[model samples]
Target: MFSHIILGARDLAALAAFYDPVLAALGLQRMPDEDDGGPAGVGWQLPGQRLPQFFVQLPFNGQPASAGNGTQVSFLAASREQVDAAWAAALAAGGVDEGAPGVRPRYAADYYGAYCRDPEGNKLCVVCWG
Candidate 1:
């Protein structure tokens, strides 16, 4: 449904530090530094695929990066364990907990997910559907 999703960040290095491990937990690998010369940022995508990338970078407007209210990005996990691992990685990498890993029956009978805010306060969710 999307080509890519980019989150604005004030600190590119800090964003990489937080996203590297967290995305790894969900089996996403950071793309090699091709230095596209577009902007200062980093991106990650599922191994061996090209589209649907996730990126964190400075705002193009040259202003401070701020999280949009009610905005969120959700990633699909292969299993509940991946959801837990991603959540753990997020918190360990300077993210804050928004919700712990658990079943969210309200979403679905097999919904298991966790939520956290990135170091820059962007909301994220890791979810698994059994």
Candidate 2:
């Protein structure tokens, strides 16, 4: 029911740097060689997906990293190791730790999840289901 998921950012470059590795760990490769310079300044595709390939474009009007409240993105990790790696990387890359990586026995005995706010305060999560 959705065409594509595009987010407004204050800086496409920084956002890409933040997103690329985390998504890649999930087997999503950054689409290469596609820049149109339109409102959607650039695009990155996750090849061979069930739905439309995902893309990230520059915010047409305002600055990049304009993520607002009520916005959250979750990337799945293959194992708890990945979740820990993601959390560490995010912290090094200017993300604020929202929740530490560990099993949330309250949520579920094996619900391992890590949460952080991106440079723009968007709630991003890396979760592992063991």
Candidate 3:
């Protein structure tokens, strides 16, 4: 339902470092740099697909980037293992844990998810629904 989701970042390189491995765990690959022409940022999408991209970039308004309260970006994971891998990768890449990987029955019986804040403080969730 999204053409793209862009998170404003103060440092593009640092944000890329955190997202690269985390998205890779969820089966996303970085889009070619040549495709990201509008802003100084990096984008990721499912391999061979063009839409539904996720990007981290410097603010377009020439202001400092700030995380929005009560805002989050969630990615789908293929399995519980992928959720774990993504969460582990996030933490290892300087993300802060919001919730550890586990079954979240409140969402669904087989909902497994992990939550974290990116290095730029953008909240993210990786979830698997079995």
* Predicted model with the maximum lDDT: 1
Off by over 4 Å in 1: none
Task: For each candidate in turn, give its C-alpha RMSD to the true structure in angstroms.
Answer: 0.9, 2.9, 1.2
Error of 2 at 79 (Å): 0.8
Ranking by lDDT: 1, 3, 2
lDDT for position 89 in model 1: 97
Q: Write the per-residue lDDT of candidate 2 for residues 1-130, one digit (tens) a residue.
A: 4546676766767877887766665566776554466764444445765454555666666554467678877766789988988888888888899999999999889889999987767788889888
Worst 10 residues of 3 by lDDT: 32-41
Distance from true position, residue 79, model 3, in Å? 0.5
Better of 1 and 2 by TM-score: 1
Q: In candidate 3, what are the lDDT values of residues 1-109, reduced to their tens digit?
A: 8899999999999899889999999889998886445668888999888889998988889899999999999998999999999999999999999999999999999
RMSD in Å for candidate 3, one decimal?
1.2
Model 2 clash pairs are 9-64, 9-65, 10-63, 10-64, 10-65, 11-64
lDDT of 3 at 25: 93
The clash count of every prediction, one per candidate, is 0, 6, 0
Candidate 1: count of backbone clashes, pairs at least 3 residues apart or interchain: 0
